[model samples]
Target: MASLSSLLPAPTQQVWDRDDERKAKRVGSALVVSQTSVPPYGQRKGWVPRAEEDFGDGGAFPEIHVAQYPLGMGARGKESTSNALAIIYSKLTDLLPSEVLAEDDPTLQKPDDEDIQDITEKTKLALEKLTNAKISAAMPVKAAPKAVS
Candidate 1:
C-alpha cells in the first residue's frame, strides 16, 4: 500500500512575506464590503430592510422558500443566519481530501443519472427534508380573494 505522504506532491512554492502582505492589503481593500444589515426598524444610510429578522416572517419567508444556488448566505456574515449553511457545508466538504470526503452525509453525496428528472427529484427531496413539508405545498398558494364585487 502506498503511504499517503508518497501520494502527495512536495511544495515547490517559495514564501514571499512582503508580497503576501501587499496582496492581502490590496485584496482587503478591494473586497471591503459593509456586511451588516439594517435593524428591522430604523433609518440610516445603506440600511436595507432588516433581512435577518424579516426572513422569519410567517408569510412564507423568501429565503426559506426559494432554492438559491450556493444555498447559504450570499456574503460572509450572512451564512450563519440564512439557514442556508447546507450549501456552504457542501462546498467545504468538496474541498476536502478524497478519503475524508467519501462519507455518506447526504450533503456530500453525489447523485446518479445526470438528468433533469433526477436533479429535480433530489432537490425536492432535500428541500422537503429540510423544511419538513412538500416543496410545492410549502409554497403560499394564491386563491384570488373572491373578486371584491
Candidate 2:
C-alpha cells in the first residue's frame, strides 16, 4: 500500500498534520504597520513642513509597508476577518465525515449515459433553432449590376 505522504507533492508531504508547523512559523513572524502622508506644496509656503525622519517620496511608504507584512496582510488587516472565516470553513469541512464530503460534492458525481445523451440532444436542438432564427432575421442583399466599360 502506498503511504499518504507519497501521494502529496514533495513540498506539502509533511503539511497534513492538524497544526501545520509551517503555518505556525509564519504566524510567529512580526507584523508591522506604518502610515504615510504626502504634504501639499503652496506657492508661498513651498512644501509643508514634515518631520525630517517621517519625510519620504511616495515609493518609500509602500516598500517599507510591504517589507513589514510581506504577505499583503494590509488588505486583510489586523482583524483577521478573512482568516477567521477560512478557519471556520476548514473546521466545518473537517467535521463532515469523509464519505459525506466525497458523496455530497456535486462535482464528484458523473452524469449517467442517458443524462449526457439527453443534454447533448437538447443543446443541438437549441443551437439549430438559434441558427435558423438568425438566418430568418438576416436581410437579403442585392448585388449591383456590372457596369459596361
Candidate achieving the largest lDDT: 2
Q: What digit string (tens of lDDT, one per residue) describes model 2 on residues 29-76?
A: 779645555544333233332343344532234323223332334434
* Predicted candidate 1 versus true structure: per-residue lDDT over 26-71, tens digit per residue: 8779566656543443344343333444334323233333433243
- Overall lDDT per candidate, in order of appearance: 0.55, 0.56
Q: In model 1, which regions exceed 4 Å deviation?
A: 1-13, 16-22, 28-34, 38-149
Candidate 1 Cα lDDT to native = 0.55
* Pairs of residues at least 3 apart in sequence or in different chains that clash in candidate 1: none
